[model samples]
Target: MHVPDGFINAPVSAAAGLAAAGAVAVSLRGARRELDDRTAPLAGLVAAFIFAVQMLNFPVAAGTSGHLLGGALAAILVGPHTGVLCISVVLLMQGVLFADGGLTALGVNITVMGAVTVLVAYGLFRGLVKVLPRSRRSVTVASFVASLVSVPAAAAAFTAIYAIGGTTDVPLSKVLTAMVGVHVLIGIGEAVITTATVGAVIAVRPDLVYGARGLAAPLKLRVGGELVDATPAPAPVEPVAARSTKKVWITGLATALVLAGFVSFYASASPDGLEKVAADQGIDKKAEEHAAADSPLADYGVSGLTDARLSGGLAGTIGVGGTVLVGTGVFWAVRRRRAGAPAPAERETV
Candidate 1:
């Protein structure tokens, strides 16, 4: 959920911003271990895709709607560290370019939506993956459950944050009730999207999915009349085989473009979970004007295009393209840095 300005006080927003900045810094390092030629570029596509899907808000209640948060989906596809960075990038893009989320409240959104959701979802996904059968179905099931829980957990996090730095004098209990209630419904939508997307990706390329790496079922083997678990050996590391990431990157970018450029125009215009909760709980009484509201591309519609559908479609396309290019550049640099200094002996011998 995109938190607009004035919901939280300035000090809390700054504090949250600092925390988000720190998490992003740490994720950059962690992504190095998680990223490679294949996954790095794919990571950028993931960000753009998340950005695109978020535009399409599916109806949750009669008047309320929700969209893909992408925390669980990202973590299941990539890794938790990278997932946080993905959502953070999307939130930042929306805040600065589209006047969607508040620039001042960027930290709040990152903390509640990015950090909290990813942490909870990834932790749950890992735990389930360890206990459940090592099958694609199990992975999908785990992803669904993880995604279901993450949304309410994020809502709880926002409740606590609002209790501390809320601009209005709304009742904490009411805020919690409304926030959790609507978001729980939103979580189901998130679960379906996360499970379906992760399952589809795993079906196509399990090797590229970070969460499914080295995952294998332990077959039972009889030895000396006693049953034993025979775990499969880890696959050998092959450097050259990792170079196929370019295709995945291109595919993800293309998918994002198609969704944002065309599908986003059909997105529901109803208020999202956060907006509904805020309006219900009086938390939005002090909503501040966005600093970037005057931008040409503000509000996910082109400035000159009078046709609502055409204007929104053009804005979505540009956003997807910009995010892909920027995110791809960042992730490519990360992969290059990680690909440094192939064996020193090999270098010296060469």
Candidate 2:
């Protein structure tokens, strides 16, 4: 959920900002291990995809709607460290460019929606993958469960933060109950989107899916009377052309553009889980206007554009393009920092 300004007191908000900053710093280091020539660019596309899908909010309750948080989906596709960065980038873009989330509340949104969701989902996903059968379907199943749980986990995190710094006098129990209840419904939507996206990627290019890697069943051989693990044959090295990520990257970018630029028009117009809960529980009593409300792209529409569809579509496209550019640059930098050397592919060009 995108926390607006004034919902949390300055002291707590500042603390959350520090915590979020620390987390981002740690993720930048950890992402060095996760990113490389192939996956660095892919990570950017994942962030843009998350941004695009988040626009298609689906109805959760009569008046409440939900959208993809993208924590589990991104973690399953890339890695947890990179997943946090992805969501953070999306939240930042939405806040500064679209006036969707308040700039003052950026840390709160990143902590709850980026850090909490990614940690809970990725941790749970890894655990489930270990216990379940090592198969593509198992990866998808784990993704579904992990994503479903992450949404409520994030909701609880917000409730805890509000309990400490909430600006209003709403009962903690009521707020917690309402937030968790509605977010549980939202979690289902998150699960479906995560599962579908993970499954689709695993089907096409399992190698690109970080969580699906090493899922191929090990070979077995019968020695004497007992079955024994067989030594795996060396994998054949394909031509450089065969290993190129250009096709997948192009396909993913196209999909993101289509979703944000067109499909978002049909999304539900109702308020999302957090917005509904805030309005019902008086949590927005002290909410301040977004500092970027005057931006041309405020409210996901372009300034001086009369057609609702055209304005929103253009804004969405711009968001996707900007996210991809920023995300790719950030990830590529992280990749270059690995072991204080550029990735192998980069060295090839050098």
Candidate 3:
């Protein structure tokens, strides 16, 4: 959920900002191991796709809706560290450019929506995959379950945070119940989206799926009463050209653009889980207006476009493009840091 300003007191918000910063710093280092030449670019596409899908909010209750948090989906497709960065990037873009989330509450959104969700989902997914069969179906199943749990877990995290730094006098029990209850419904939608997306990717290019890697080891066959590996030995790493993800990246980016630029128009207009919970529980009593509320792109609409469809479409397209550019730049920089020689500062100076 995109926490707006004043929902949490300034002190708690500042603490969360420090936590978010620390998480991002740790993720950047961890992502170096996850992002390679081929996967680095895919990380950007993941962020763009998450940004797009988040626009298509589906109805959860009569007046409540929810959208893809993208933690599980991103973690399953890429890796957890990169997944956190992907969502952090999207939240940042939405806060600064789109005004969907408040700038002051950026850390709250990042902590709850990015760090918590990714950690819970990735941990659960990894655990489930270890106990289940090592097939594509198993991976999809894990993705679904992991996604389902992550939403409520994030809700719980928010509840804990609010219990400590809430700006309103709402009862902690009420907040927890409402938040968890609505988000559980939202989790179903999250599960469906994550499962379908992960399944599709696994069907096409399992190699690109970080979680699915090494899932299905070489089968063994019994020979002369002894079991032996049936699959051929692994081949050497492919060249950068041979391993390029041009086709997949292009296809994913096109899908994101289509979803955001067009399909987002049909998404539900109701308040999402957090918004509904806040309004009902009085957690939003002190909510402040977004700093960018008057911006041209605020509320996901172009400044001059009168047509609702055209305005939203242009805004969505711009968001996708910006997210890709920024995400790719960040991920590429992280990858290069991993590949480049030691910095002069770290080297022994004469």
Q: lDDT of each structure?
A: 0.89, 0.93, 0.94
Residues 1-350 of candidate 2 have per-residue lDDT tens digits of 89999999999999999999998999998898888899999999999999999999999899999998898898889999999999999999999999988888899999999999999999999999999998898999999999999999999999999999999999999999999999999999999999999988888888999998888888889999989999988989899898899999999999999999999999999999999999999999999999999999999899999999999899999999999999999999898878577668998998
What's model 2's overall lDDT? 0.93
- How far residue 90's Cα lies from its native spot in candidate 2, in Å, is 0.7
Which candidate has the highest lDDT of all? Answer: 3
RMSD of 2: 3.3
| Candidate 2 segments whose C-alpha is farther than 4 A from its true place | 339-350
TM-score for candidate 2: 0.96
Local error of candidate 1 at residue 119 (angstroms): 0.5
Please give the distance, in angstroms, between residue 283's alpha carbon in candidate 1 and its true position after superposition: 0.9
lDDT computed for candidate 1:
0.89
Q: Could you tell me which residue pairs clash in candidate 1?
A: none
TM, every model: 0.93, 0.96, 0.95
TM-score for predicted model 3 compared with the true structure: 0.95
Rank candidates, TM-score, best first: 2, 3, 1
lDDT of 3 by residue, 1-350 (tens): 89999999999999999999999999999999999988999999999999999999999889999999999998889899999999999999999998898898889999999999999999999999999987899999999999999999999999999999999998899999999999999999999999999998888889999999998767899999999999787889877787668999999999999999999999999999999999888899999999999889999999989999999999999999999999999999999999895766777663
